[model samples]
Target chain A: MSRFARPHWVEKMSSGMAKPLIGEISAALDTLAATGVAGAIDLSGLPLTATDRAELEVALGSGEVEAKVTAAGTSEIRETGFAGVWWVRHFDAGGRVLAEILEIAFVPQLLGAQGDDIDAAARRLRTELARTPERETGRETVHAD
Target chain B: MQIDETTPNAARSAASGDDRTLGALLAARGVSRRAFLKYSSYLASLLALPASMAPAMAASLAKAQRQSVIWLSFQECTGCTESLTRSLSPTLDDLIFDFISLDYHHTLQAASGHAAEEARMQAMEAHKGKYIVAVDGSVPVKDGGIYSTIAGMSNLDILEETTKDAFAVVAIGSCAAFGGLPLADPNPTGAVPVTELVTDKPVINIPGCPPIPEAMAAVLAHVLTFGILPELDSLGRPKSFYGESVHDRCYRRPFYDRGEFAESFDDEGAKKGWCLYKLGCKGPATSNACATVKWNGGTSFPIEAGHPCLGCSEPGFWDMGGFYRALSVPTGDVARIAAVAAGAGVVAGAAAGALHRATKSAARGKHHTVTVEELEEK
Candidate 1:
């Protein structure tokens, strides 16, 4: 009979650092429970190892929502099934990881566009349209109904 | 020295004799059970109570008798009342106004002078040891509090005498809670907060230049439903509303993390929506629901509007070395502790990262080239 060795994945999952991370997340959830306020855990601020990050990902699996928003760069937001917790990752224009945060909110504010920005964009477009010649733009003119 | 009633509404219904429960009032006003339950759930969410507690809260609030409340205004700008009145129709403020029998308010009550005092005295005598006292503005203790008086009575004396038989006292604004702007440096009136004088009764401080209307309503709802005061922090503020620092939950926090700060109010970084740390946002030291609950029905907060936080909710904020000074420069223990904690977190994180990487090999797997399209697909 041959004895079996522990799997590499199992070895990678068990780490002393994982305990504190779990504790921090638990406390954050407690804050959410006591105050309707959301919390954020900045992964960039944390000393997270590849193995630790991987372990965390495995433990807190994704839920129903997964959103990828593009603005100055790209931001990917994923909600965990547990307690409205979210995993938000922001990337710069160069596609480099800018920030990795664990946010707790009903909706991730990072992925949602700001109302002011949307208003600015619309105003810019209207100004540009007014400046452009209607024939050159190759679009039908809009009229109020 | 009896004062005549100016309006017929001055002779309001006797608060003690009106035995109609809040639920019956709502029913009479054509409010449905479902709507009340929904409002209760919203309040629960705002109060940070569990979803399970909503039905219980609704039931309790429904059966609750209208409690008598005496609202006192002194050494104030009436901004707190203005903020409360700004709430739209059917808002929590309106609901709370409906829930409680506001027996006396110098600003809102039709009664004035001795008539107003008479109404207040009647309510106090009728519901002694049970009525709620909501106070705005600070009590000027200097020269026997002559700086601010109502009906020729000092604010200090009136507050002391009125709250003597009160169940609880709700300090409704930063002025009444922490002496506010009037208590700033070189305070001539010797303004003091309610917590400083009324130590015998439970005093809940809802501190803000003009506190969020919903915050006041939430505290009143908690008291009316549970017949007890909500859990408060060491600062005598409700823990739920004043639990987290504005910096922690700010929308621009990611910009702060990236070390992108707007040096000036009108700079390019400001236009690009960078962090306001360098511009002197007191968010790090201030703890309030402004970031989350927001103002004017969740329109925006000070930080969201591109202005740095004034830390108006915190005590002594008016004297916190100018509102435009960076938080990096410490004014007190709170700012110092926050900076020290940040430094410690970075050190701890780096050390942990180094330890975890120590066990790994220097050589890693071959790099994989991926397109943006592929990432998008994933």
Candidate 2:
């Protein structure tokens, strides 16, 4: 019975269906270009096999922009070879991928600094400056303009 | 694994008469805008919403006030509460605590007895029609609900009163969602799910023996961020999590398609990691996120660990045949046979037979044999 058993299931990871996914991404990119509307495809929600993912990665290649955002976890956003396409992966503290997305946009939304944060930064800076001796002594206002 | 024990600065300020938005609270804790953006994007993906909605979700969450939550336990094992506290995702646990003011929970609260009760009443009165009511156990309505009571108040009465002005009623576990184990066959106490009693409010069912922690957090986050309930399925479960059957997402799906099955626990096929359908896996009939979101921080689900799905998320699962019996096999008086079979299976067959009869009688529907091609279409 042992001899008659088939190969291990791990060997069947490749579904050989990456071409259609690439086509779908191309179509999304086209839509973004035409309508100026960014779109995203949730890779985690798809049924892509390991080989399919590998094929997609190779097809997309890599672009110049790459940044990491740390919040609830660490998110890595990198531009694909295509100018308007980006690959985003959000990982938990334990380094587990929580979500994988392919975004079609000029820049991923997570890269931009929000208005609330900028306001908070300004207040925080003012508080720090108030605690400085130079500011208290009236030496910081040297620019008369 | 590092739990931040210090109370967030925003929470402290809120206590000191500073009414601040969640954005101010987060910023006080030195959480940057990028973090919010990342979390919002992650939430959007998790909720199956379009990626374009991430910015809006973030904006809404930032401007929103902290939500008041009241947790009421009935005839339960406290496993649901345990599951929630042990949420594997690091940030989600913090985010949930930061987003809500848990005014009442018997197990976790410092104040007990009268004080705890008063806190719940106060929160209800203050928040009124805005607070969320999360219930975790089946309500024993038999004997005038004398089977279970807190402070001499019956579970039924408490549920009705608490949910009267609630924004939404969240059924936290299988017991609260589908009348879990307590409602099985010879249900002596006449237990029923939360939906039966709370008819006015939107009841979101997150059913499992002890539901996946992330699913619970995600539902709460969706509600808190959007100021409304997430889209629910026919059974009142969030479609984002319960949209697909376990088998549809299982890695062993290829084996099932090839007709390769594990015959027994220690068989060659089992060792070779074949499909467990023959050994009574309930994956096909079960709709849950266990296959994808998994448990224990994306490590592995029951199927990955070589156990067949118990179909814990579905209604009347406790009565649905035996765990080791195939779904294709029709059951007859399973409750009685389960007794003779003893420990081999729980309340076997009869419940499944009853369900089939119920479905047929209600819909006058025919049970058609599905072909491989038809299954592929789905």
Candidate 3:
């Protein structure tokens, strides 16, 4: 299932629009960024391949956005929009993963028997993300003149 | 694959006197370096050590021997044992045999009754002054200690007998550490922690409802290798694992700091995995490795599993209050205005009162004012 589909239930209760869900996703990514989870994944799965990273270069160019093969599972952020990756085994693709990503994570230190580095990375990434200047998206001012 | 060698220098000298690398050291002792290093690296991370210490730890581990452990079950459920035995990674047996020798665990051992008592006695005698004694459940000291007994002896007597010559006494589970459910208010059993009963020996209390299995294993390791207990907090819990509050390490801590809280169980906060403190999460006060170490094989914990903390590790946790009652935290700068307003009101009232007095005094002090009015006055 698509990652957005989980939180999209809230959107179903909306006026049949997905903007609320998208907003939730944005907030979730922000929180994750504050926690050192910096990248974003598109759950619609456009037949992504090893080379598709280059094909989605336009999306990747957004600076806040990055794409890679996340471990198959919903990253639940709860209904505003977006999903949190369930385990770090998926984040094997993060920070430049290697071949047999599954093997390296399953080696016991990553997530299975013992948890590793998720806390430090989350703190570091989130602090760094919070400091970035807002990428203006036209709603900068709705002030009452 | 389990190298139970405890002579670092011997293992080194034995391996052609080459002192570098777990590869060479374990190879000298006929243990696979990969397997040893693999476990060592995992243990190092569990202790929150940097990646650089992996080699040194592995090398030192070549001489790490399995200390004989006699598991003593006291007045309680077998949850702690169950938590350890069910570990999914290397498995708890791997921990028991590979690291420390579990000489006699009543639940896991095949022997029972007279044979079980004999085994425990032998373990204490054979490994005398060197064995590790792990106690689960609390010791009921009331009514002549008749509340719980093993082999016709009260738990208090058994603990005293078993721990008399032990290297270190470890209190596992909340029952043994902080007196689990049996310790709740109006404790008829008069349950007391092992630390209360064992005054002669050093006791390490791993006090959770059931402490994370890795935490249990880590304590055992530090005890075996260093021959010194890990630095413990004021409550006798090892600082490496119980140093910080679960809330401090929780993933939802940010939401909490921002003044957001889960208002209800099934609300958006639960879905967002936001802070559950407002909903009476004891993470702020209770200490354990739950947030980062997690559970269900390091996957999640009570908060992540969408439950508030019951404060199982803290003393008098069961009686202090309900799990859902918001702990009375200082209302922060948010309520500072009340005091400020109070001060302002006192000053304002005094000023008003003083102004009236001053007006009366001026009239009384008047020398040439209102002479005609004085004449017209009756």
DockQ comparisons of all candidates to the true complex: 0.02, 0.39, 0.02
By DockQ rank, best first, the candidates go: 2, 3, 1
What is the per-residue lDDT of model 2 for residues A1-145, given as tens digits with 9 covering 90 to 100?
0001123443335666678778888998999889988888777666665556777889899999999887778888999999999999888888877778888898887777778878877888999987898665666466542
Q: After superposing candidate 1 on the true structure, give the runs of residues whose Cα lies further than 4 Å from its correct spot.
A: A1-145, B1-16, B88-93, B328-340, B344-378
Which wins on DockQ, candidate 1 or candidate 3? 3
Candidate 2, residues B132-197: lDDT per residue as tens digits? Answer: 999999999999999999988999999999999999999999999999999888899999999999
Task: Using lDDT, rank the candidates from best to worst.
Answer: 2, 1, 3
Best by DockQ: 2
| Chain A TM-score relative to the true structure, per candidate | 0.68, 0.78, 0.20
User: Candidate 3 residues B171-206, lDDT tens each?
Assistant: 998899988788777899999989999998999999
Better structure of 1 and 2 per TM-score: 2
Q: Per-residue error at B284 for model 1, in Å? A: 0.5
Give the winner by lDDT: 2 or 3.
Answer: 2
Clashing pairs in 2: B321-B349, B334-B350
Work out the TM-score per prediction. Answer: 0.65, 0.85, 0.60
Q: Give the TM-score of candidate 1.
A: 0.65
lDDT agreement of model 1 with the native: 0.69
